[model samples]
Target: INTGAIKSEAASSMEMTELQNTESGEIISGNLHILANSTIDNKGLVNVNQLFIDAETLNNQPDARIYADNATLNTSTLNNNAILAARNNVSISTETLFNNKNAEIVSQGNLQIAGVSIGGALTSAHQVINSGGRIEASGDIAINTDELQNLNAGITTQWVTDSIERIIEVQPEGWAHKYDVSRFPLIHNHNVEGQPFTDENGNIIRYFEDYTYYDYTAKTQSTHIISSAPAKIIAAGNIELKGNVLNSDSQIVAGQKLNISGGSLQNSATPGQKRVSYNGTRQFRDWDGNDEELDFGGIAPYSPAPKNTEFNLGVSLFEDSHADIKSLANIQTMTLPVVNSAMFSLVAKPTKFYIETDPQFLDYRDWLSSDYMLQKLAFDPANTMKRLGDGY
Candidate 1:
């Protein structure tokens, strides 16, 4: 279809196959299921209630969009790089999802993207929960997961391994002189152990060397995440996160080994109370700031006023009225639905919890520095037992 909309209504299921291209308009329905060897390149919009795709190959371009409240996809390959992107809610599963490194998954509710490989980023109003695979949120991220190794949801953040490593780099002789090594002439070289330098008279010289080292220590970002509602992601196997795991709150029970590396683990939450607006009798304030109920008030205002009186339309029965004409009391009110909000929670456990830094990554930072350089490794969460090269 070049333009306009297409609605398919069949009893069992509807299928759109052998289609290579599609343009404008939107296809909105209750549920959706896409098959392989088909292309749905809608320029306008493509909205569905529950969306599923089992295509061998799927391509989502700069202008394409596939929106749904819940999505479950199993594609061998996918390309989603839309400028506006798709607004997908609920949990999403993929076999091998490839998103634009720049494009992000936009959602207002809980999101779980578990796949063999994921390339894009995720932006949510609720949380990025873990069901399987590995995930990491860069900064200001909210974490909510399903299960833990040998444990259930709502377990405290546990550290399995914490240690430090030294990164050694060998440079040419003139390299030290060019950068001026006066500030840090020598350091305790972890690699070159017990090798001593000698003077012309065979007298022993200083044993320390000139290479730089990094301490891979464990540091907590935030304590724990707190939220009103709870969420969980249960998986059958181990859940490992090679990147950062940032969350606002949760409780967890670990079942297997949970591993992370080359990333940070964070849990944060901002808690506050909301003041309720009361609809009652108005009070008159005196010049001194003291206030009292007006004398005209018969009794205190009883029921709450409708935020909107008309929309609150409903039938009501009246009780016995006052027999005498002088009696008063005749006012109707209704309480409509209000107080809707979004909440998030997270929990994860593994047989072990690990967040270790990669010493090889030290070259990315201050490699040009000289004379007792500080090799600072990027904050990376660990997922396994780590040992210094020589220690093991």
Candidate 2:
């Protein structure tokens, strides 16, 4: 258990790695491997060339930082509060993971997280998985969980737009003074019917005449470029939620396809309420304005029931993934307000599919017309060919 500050010179490299710090610790190593039961408390820094931490539970506190060329953290529980960055790949496997308070786990290469519950802000040059934390990747993003709650975060893999330019010279009239005259051998040899140029004496000259033009105009050769790679976000689970706000922070934007296989997707401000109906004769509706009444038509009615008898059913009003109700009925639906631009897919098998959008629904047309979204969103097709800055 290291409590005091451990310092190493820039040239130094420690080989061993087993950290159980109570408060603070720092390791500067070439290659390190942290065994089980290791914890990095506040202000801890693990900077190494390669790091592999196979611990029971690895908790990186708010001020902690871990930097490496490549890292692999295999733990039962991983609670990171600060940053875990790597130049190459960063693979983290855990049963339970919590990346709280805007914590970041970034990788310049690929990143993979296999866990039961995942919550964090993850950014990678390749692949990643995240919850109500911002997930940005250049490649694919695959997340398989039991339940996902992205209250106020986004998953985006925007297009990669870049441009190049070259300078072109424009001449008004005559050829330049430095023009090569060797090609016109007839003018120099005086063997053709008409000489290239006449001398001052109005006689054909053996030598070619110089144009003597030095001034030339220069113009920019601009090429507008628009390209995008295949970026997909596949979120498969029982339930998923990507906030109800209309801001950019809650959007799920993919360059290519956004495939979501979930039992329910609640995207509205108001939760989808469920209604209870006793028998086929009597009907009880959801108290909320938009109630999805459940039909118990096939099932038998309550036996020996009083006038106001209420049988306790093991189901919550907002729990859409009720095992009993889900098996009996079809509740696989998506409540998405804004769907625009890219290709979108929702997989709720063996049920009549439907999408419930907000009253004030917005699509690509609205997104392109909005001043705020125009300035904020990436790769607007309307301005794809328009020259705005130094490069398009």
Candidate 3:
């Protein structure tokens, strides 16, 4: 039948067209074959067992969806900005399949299509597309479109029809969702439906890559960037870092040179690894108010050393990654704080010494004895002493 809208009706024997939204309607079951062009402008879900569409053109809306077990379309053009699913296989032999503008697909079997501008994505056990097809995708993509390899993948949609005609080419043995600009080619596909990632086994996820030259003027003051994975910047040209660039695994690789004429590439500043512990350095207020009689009357310990003397100094300092920084500009020679920011916690105590008073020269008891020369009377009647500088 050739019509715009189609609703199935009961039939005696029809297996492929048992379609129904809710069970409230009549048990209509029939098969239909479209011979001319058709457009499904629906917003609800459509489920069918098998469908054979030989229409000249198929135009689907934004929220429309057509699901079937196996679908074949020999149309001239298939502009699908909606969803199309098939449980078995989907073969489109159209001249051009503009699966752009939010078009999505799911194939439980295999999918083969020939097109020029392929902006949408398909999930199948196996997907094969003809050459000269530009595809933007993530997750595992087994593609053989090497004819359009010379196209430069710009970082936007402008790369789609750039006269050279850029196509989102997936690397061999690489998932479309795992493109690392530093290690692999830049993922210049934008607005692809397989992005905003998901963990579904049959989904094509999206990844990110940094641009070569990012600019910042007075108008662009504060900016915050958040990513699901580590951020990387790989440039064949120059880069100017102006503000604070923070990342868990932030890396910047330049092929030839980089021009950082202004702003610094300094990391977060933290205090050095240093600590001090006072040993036997506590001071008391002479609680009993008797300094000379404390040794005899009280049981407290006393030292003959003066108050200005140092008792002990326990300093614990060690070298860190910052100390190993040989040069600030020569990033290759020295270690980077980004790689070695984690410090090891350890304590190295200082050596403490105990002075002995048992020797004759150091004995305070001998010096304080009454027989010593210091204990002799200063002015005596029978004292015999020479004047100063005359005799000792």
Query: Candidate order by lDDT, highest to lowest?
Result: 2, 1, 3
CA lDDT scores, all candidates in order: 0.34, 0.42, 0.32
Q: Pick the candidate with the highest lDDT.
A: 2
lDDT of 1 by residue, 108-163 (tens): 33344544333664321122332211221211112222211111123232222222
TM-score of each model, paired residue for residue: 0.30, 0.37, 0.28
Ranking by TM-score: 2, 1, 3
- Top model number, TM-score: 2
Q: Could you tell me which residue pairs clash in candidate 3?
A: 9-29, 134-167, 138-176, 138-177, 139-176, 139-177
lDDT of 3 at 174: 31
Q: Give the C-alpha lDDT of model 1.
A: 0.34
lDDT of 1 at 51: 68
Error of 2 at 157 (Å): 28
Model 3 lDDT tens row, 194-251:
3344322555445322212111111111111221121222333333322223212223
Q: Candidate 2 — which residues are off by over 4 angstroms?
A: 3-18, 22-24, 38-42, 116-132, 153-251, 261-264, 268-392
